[model samples]
Target chain A: MSAALQDLDARIVRATQGGLPRVPEPYAALAATLGVSEAQLLERFAAMLADRRVRRIGVVPNHYALGYTANGMSVWDVNDAQVDALGRQVGALAFVSHCYRRPRRPPDWPYNLFAMVHARSRDEVEARLGEIRALLGAALRAHDVLYSTRILKKTGLRLS
Target chain B: MDELDRVIINRLQGGFPLCTRPFAAAAAELGTDEATLMARIEALLGDGTLTRFGPLFDAERLGGAFTLCALRVPEADFERVAAQVNAHPEVAHNYERAHEFNMWFVLGTRAPADIARVIAAIEAETGLAVFEFPREAEYFIELRLAA
Candidate 1:
């Protein structure tokens, strides 16, 4: 990675990992702390975004607080050859939050395609899974929902 | 949430502008005042409606490594094992899912090799096999929750 992208300007990550300030001029406030001009900070941010270092700059709402209490990790057993294409389809569904293709350990774990479905209730999640099932169709040989019983720990990365 | 709250949640999901007065700019677009907009955001975050508000970094892109790992904790030992696994600083998100392989968590480390080291540590600590499922390919990843 280029120096601009390497380590992602540690100062910025360390300073803003918790969050950017909530002030009217939050960037300016953050730049002040980092002892950099607002323009320089924004320039780095833009570069980070362009290089896919920063996924987004926005609010990450608490799904549970927003009534999306039921979160189901819907795992699907898809044909290996067609997993990528089908995974993309499953990922595009409106209700799916995160979708990825993972290595499946046979006998013990046969599911390869994983999509996270969040909804207000189990029924809603089931309904959405049904939609995903239809989308997967033949590619989806079998599937199961691993509903989250509890959140053991949830926090952002801590770069030591 | 009230109408104004919904407006803020929905609109801000896309992005917050980078400007001298971003809240003011957003308020102008949403037809609200800067103070009210800022206040609403603070309230939302304070009340746990918003979990986070800032730039979402890609750990891997930043010269770090991350992996989704699972552990098949025994039903009777779930709590104990979870505590042991979560004690590690590298473990970011951990959840108890209703399945045989019930415990799932994401591990992030500054170096790629630290992933195995962390998993080994967790296994030794919990005496449970850590099933590491690093992403072979990312089909999609978007964390937009519509209000």
Candidate 2:
């Protein structure tokens, strides 16, 4: 619902999307580049985080490198009337990282709810899926897990 | 990864202070020194133990648009099609999964309209139907994986 970041705000995204510099005074360093006071930059960052323009400002461990080898996109066909409510519960589960309700392309794809689950192995992931299955109960019509075979590309954000 | 590394990964997943000496403040709570904490984070990022370490933007909240799109690229055409699909800068992430609609990627655009444009371009370039999955509602999105 938000509009494009403008002026200095847009510059901040372009500069720091890759990451903030790892330094004792990283914000000060960044502010210098943007020709703004450190206090000004911090204020903007705080506002962005509060508004969810910036989701978070911290570690993003690569699941593969951290031994979380099993990653599955578990999709479910839930009753449309109950999808939003059910999605909230599925997303609250400990193992579900990301969850959403999306339009289903009937005949080809019937899943309207998607949840990403990760674990150390396939068995572990399946067990987690079982938990989701139990949670959805009768509302869960069908489900499938799309296990990623390879990361063809994972380039970072591009400034527009 | 050692115990300390694990602690860092689990502890600093969010709420990393935005102060002048943010690492120092975080280190105090983690029972570690700032130098050690900074070094650990640098090493983690350098070796790909961590994919990213900074502000994670919500493109939608920033007036940008994003969509998860998929296409069923046949075995013979995967590699070639992958290259073609990746050629579009809008495609932020592309992955091959074990499903009929095996090729999935996330498209990020500055505006909502740009998303459809990118999808059309990809469909034209790949000669395949682009199945766009735009989220109707996004639930809680907390991704803190214990390392």
For model 1 the local lDDT of residue A159 reads 58
Off by over 4 Å in 2: A1-5
Q: Write the per-residue lDDT of candidate 1 for residues B17-129, one digit (tens) a residue.
A: 77788888878998999999989989999999998888888777777889999989889998899889888989999998888889999999888999999999998888888
Q: Docking quality tier of candidate 2?
A: medium
Error of 1 at B146 (Å): 2.1
Q: For model 1, what is the C-alpha lDDT against the true structure?
A: 0.86
Q: Name the Cα RMSD for model 1.
A: 2.0
